[model samples]
Target: MRCSSWIRVAVASALLVFTASAASATLVVPEPSDGIEVLVSSSCRDRLDVSLRIDEKSSPGELVFTLSITGPGSTRGDLRGFFLNLADESLLDGLSISGPFVTGSQLAANAVIGISTGYTAKSHRHAGGSSNPFDLGIELGTPGISKDDLQTVTFTLSHATRALGLADVSGQTFGVHAMSVGKGRCRTGSCKLTGVIPVVPEPGTALLMGLGLAGLALPGRRRA
Candidate 1:
């Protein structure tokens, strides 16, 4: 085929695919459900937030998980360590934790992880408050977050793969259970906590859409 002919075909194919994708079924996020919550103390908040969300860009056998914890107090930059139990334990390697928190495990496993939250080694726990965005307390070797204010700590992990011991989690009923967190004035492990289960779209739907796009982009000739 001529260069101009090939170019025209490519443009037409791309436009057709784009239009089809736009008109066809597209993923839409559902209404937010009340996530799990925990308690700080009798004088503190009624509930603490422990939320989890899976990325829509997850591929086969891999998942992208983002977690956040909204506490009842601030002022104290106490670095809280939230111990969570993932649905797929082997896939733990795929997650990279961030925020005013640290991973119970390695930061980099088999995923292309990126983080831009707060961090302080257990060695410099209480001294690195000025280094973080939240001039809060550092609880490394010192006191944890104080009371009387609402504090939220969140983080994102991208490109989480299921190579270690898992696979695609699409509509597979995954969960993020809050096991425990760092110690502090009021919010301790003794505080009561509830787990959250965020839902994801079925993998079959995503896969069919992907196959359609692939077929459009790379159509094959048929013999008569």
Candidate 2:
């Protein structure tokens, strides 16, 4: 193959990776199930409309959550990150749930160093009401956003599930009791933003996937 052809392939691959991992649509936050019995303060739940999901079929041993707000999103503060105390840790994969997964995508490039100071991994919280410390206290980070803007963030947990130990993880139930977020400077509407990323195929990915696939059907140059 010609060098130029290889270059095209390299560029194509890079775009695919970014397209696959970059963003997910904003989901309306769902209400916790009565069976789960973990009570996140009503005030927190009221602050933003949210939706949760556990992607057990498409991805196994991983919990995928999309928390979003409708219309103009809200801002409570600087809005660093969000958290949920695990009522049960058995759902988490002990080894795979750390590093970049802990921090937001913006800082994932330097996760190892970013985690310690950037945000809390799995720790204690009293302000929310003295929750138990973990085997699965997970925190997900976010790239900062403007107050009252439409924005959405998706969390892909390495090893978390809701089939057992709690209510079934689904649209009907979240299986969580407590939740919190870090808003360093902004408070009381200082930093809060939410929205659903539209589910349309990105133009770049569409062209790449479409043209690239069509290219495969055509003849290829023989190796030198």
Candidate 3:
């Protein structure tokens, strides 16, 4: 009977470890909307290009964006490129940009941009024409983030400029329709942005395990 009891205890302990490992391995996005949109500008014209960086806890992941622009001027741009890093000042390790496309006199600039791997939200800008590019970056910390925690980074633009023959200039209104990034590939027809899951373990889980081990080590003689 003693041997069988010991065996059962061993099996239970092993199962507990396995269950914890499996549960901890899976990363999840708790928010219903995988993506969040951040408005960057209300108006830009004369070929405006902007670049922004997104900071994440994980080493490598994916960034997806849905860009929208509205005005008489026909122009559109993608997420283009990104730089990521573990620290704020560290040299950028990975960078990626999307292929450029012309809006072709369309009323709106709507498109998707995808990026892979390491990047930092340090400095960003727009490329091309007499228009000066804008720089933007983001900082990330470990407060509410856990292995299962997922967050959305959003970018938005809402304005445009038009040239009115010779010295005349005109401005139009626009806004960000949507912006987001996620760990896994976005499924088709999904409007929300998704971000990659961080790899850190949950503090609560670790604390619970520590308590369990302490309980198992308690001596019956001491309790009595």
In candidate 1, what are the lDDT values of residues 1-224, reduced to their tens digit?
00000110011001111121122322222333222122222111223334334433333333334444444444122223333334444544445444434333333222211122333344222121111111112111123334312133444433454342122332122112221233354334312222212223234544444456544332232111
| Candidate 1 whole-model C-alpha lDDT, 0 to 1 | 0.28
**Which digits, one per residue and each the tens of the lDDT, describe model 2 over residues 108-221?**
211211123444443222211222222222334443344222233455655322333212231121212112322333433322221111122334654555455532221232
Q: Model 2, stretches more than 4 Å misplaced? A: 1-46, 71-79, 85-95, 98-116, 120-124, 127-130, 142-150, 159-224
Query: Ranking under lDDT, best-scoring first?
Result: 2, 1, 3
Candidate 3 runs further than 4 Å off: 1-31, 41-60, 71-91, 100-224
TM-score of each: 0.32, 0.35, 0.21
CA-only RMSD, every prediction: 19.2, 19.4, 23.7
Candidate with better TM-score, 2 vs 3 = 2
Q: How many clashes in each structure? A: 8, 18, 32
RMSD of 1: 19.2
* lDDT of each candidate versus the true structure: 0.28, 0.29, 0.21
Q: Encode model 3's per-residue lDDT on 35-65: one tens digit a residue.
A: 2222232222122222222222111233343
